[model samples]
Target: MKYPSLKNYINGQFVASNSARTIKVVSPVDGALLSEVTMSSAEDLNDAVEAARIAFHKWSKTPIKERVQVFFRYKFLLEKNLQELATICSEENGKTMSEAIAEIEKCIELTEFATSLPQIVTGEVLEVSKGIECRTEHVPLGVVASIVPFNFPSMVPNWTIPNAIALGNCMILKPSEKVPVSSGRIAELLKEAGLPDGVFNIVHGDIEIVEAICDHPGIEAVSFVGSTKVAKLVYQRATNNYKRCLALGGAKNHLMVMPDAIATMTAQNVVASMSGCAGQRCMAASAMVGVGPIDHIIDKICDEARKVVPGENLGAVINKESKDRIEKYITEAEQQGAKILVDGRGAKVDGKGGGTYVGPTVIDHVTPDMAVAKEEIFGPVISIMRTNTVDEALAIENANPYGNAASVFTQNGGVARYIIERASAGMIGVNVGVPVPREPFSFGGWNESRFGVGDITGKSSIEFWTKLKKSTIKWNPEAGVNWMS
Candidate 1:
């Protein structure tokens, strides 16, 4: 099927890039072309940045109430077209309908949260001394960029956009070339919400565009979500250019099961977390750390893993490259002496031309030093490691390089508390598999999993997109009398 040609949304309008080169966005579900988008170049980036810079001068001065009203209207528009956005996510990103809807719902939740920007962007006022008052306010940064990933076409961009724009900053969003459709839809909704031209813009391209965003002087800040390698490059380049960057990276989040935890229930939760979205989420548990008598736990996990059929019960990974990488990791793990308790390497999909499917795979007796155990295998595969004690499990979790999230399945309060206190992960889950925080709190990781001081979403996002200024004033009768006084 020939899908419509997609263009970049720049200066509040959809336009073709200066470069005639285009890339096909292929669906991971059936390897079919969903659409084709322009391969944007540095010139396109310059245009978007210039537009955002021009718009920021006026938009930043707009009243806070008026800006919030735009967000309110944007929230309504998002809700109205929720299904359409979700459908686009499913078509291009290869997530199931329900999963895509959930992602869109998260975007809506962020929009709703942003409508309360008045309260969120509130400043502090204090009487420092007699007749002296000090106040602080957060002012918007200019022409911030949100470089989002294909795994979350809608939600991740919302993490930066609504909050950034609500705080009165203009945005230049560079959506993933693999799934650029939803971002254009979002830009359309922002326009309908009365956002000014260039207040919200979309640029579509690959690394050159990203480098443009980093190197351009007009872009004051950037928010990104992707693999660790790319996140490091983005962070380094943006920071070196003196731009504020929030680059969230990859992870190998572990799900620790103690002796007292119910094996069957823990297995169920582990399987769900490992298989959901084909384990593309950064918080997905890539390893299961078992403490004491782990045979039964491993068996339960294997049984649960076998029940998940990719492209049927669970969706495929993002693309053929992702599928091939996952299979390679599984094979390498087996060759390196890890036992494959549940093999998903041979999983198949009917009528999908060997779609990007990797069923739930569980490997047992994996050591902490194994490459598969140490790396972030963003697929539906879980590695099992046996530890003699809870301390050992905690040590393993903490010693890992990526500290995105950690989970412990235990009814005992002590063990759960112990893991919570010592896991060294940014997000901790007790009896929960995926511990992604909600809109009220920021999402971040420690160690190599994240880069930058502030995380994405919540109040952190508000602070990241804005700069603080403090004012000190005194009401004195002789105010004009003496600057020296």
Candidate 2:
């Protein structure tokens, strides 16, 4: 399928970079040449920034009703072309078709929420003293930038874009070079929905582009979602430059299966969470803490995982690099004395000889010191670490540097309450596998998993993208008070 446009969308137009450098887009499913995207240079980013600075004056001044109307039309356009966008996302990002469609549907819901910005962006009004009023209003931060990861390309960008734009902040989106097409399509839809030139821009490149965004004086804030290592760097550099930053890093999320937990349901949820998107999700349950005789759970998960057929039930990782990395983790785990229960290495997908497929792999007898257990594999690999008590499981989960997400399976309310309250993770799942907060609630992490003041998505986004200004007013007509005084 042809992409919307292979060029960067800057200044409300599809344009090529000054360097004319191109990154070849390839399909992970079959390693086919999809398209070539123009890579933006520092100079290109400067131009985009200039355009955004100009647009911000008007966009910020635009009435909330008008801004929301544009988003309404954008939402309709998204719904109108849902299938087309979903297909593009799946083909480029190597996710299943249904997964991509579901991502688009979520994006639609986010847009729907954004259309009610007039209500959500409301500030506090209070009466102080006699005839003296005090209130606070939320206003736009100048130019903001968003750096989204390749996994869930279509969905992650919406975590910032709609909220930033709705709050009247001009935005520059830097999509992962691995899957840039989906954001390009979104830029097109934004323009179609009557977004003016420069209000929203897309810049395409790798590290240099990202560094430029951080160091650029024009950018007031930066929001990012990526590996923990990179996120730390982004946070430091952006904040060092005196710009606000919200860097959401990677996770080594754990799914603790208690003895009382339903074996079948726990296993099913584990498999679904760990293997979804080939385990490329940040919230993918890569570690399983087995509290008791969890042998049945592991066996069922391994059995179901082995049956998943690539290109049907599962898809390839983003590229061969990811596939190789996942395989190396598996091999290293075996060498370090961990048992490879079901090896995904060398697994074959039908008619996809060149594809980057790593079938679902499970490793048993994982220890805390094991590299595979500590790191974010970002693949369809689940490792079992047995613990005798709930405290042991909680210790294992909390010891990780990343506090992105964690879940516990139990029938007891007291145990669930204990885990929810004591676990260091930001987003917790009691019975649910992946606890991604919906539109209104903020989604964030703790410790190394997140940096900055506010979270992305939901109401937190409004605060992240806007600044607050307080006003104190007094009117004393009887005393003839001077306005300046």
lDDT of 1 at 353: 78
Query: What total of clashing residue pairs does each candidate reach?
Result: 0, 0
- Candidate 1, residue 343: Cα displacement in angstroms equals 1.2
lDDT of each: 0.88, 0.89
For residues 209-238, what per-residue lDDT tens digits would candidate 1 score against the true structure?
999999999899999999999999999999
- Model 2, span 27-134: residue lDDT tens: 887877777787889999999999999999999999887898988999999999999999988888888998889999999989988998899778888865556678
In model 1, the worst 10-residue window by lDDT is 476-485
Off by over 4 Å in 2: 1-5, 479-485
**Residue 459's lDDT in candidate 1:** 75
Instruction: Report residue 177 deviation for candidate 1 (angstroms).
Output: 0.9
Tell me the lDDT of model 1 at 460: 75
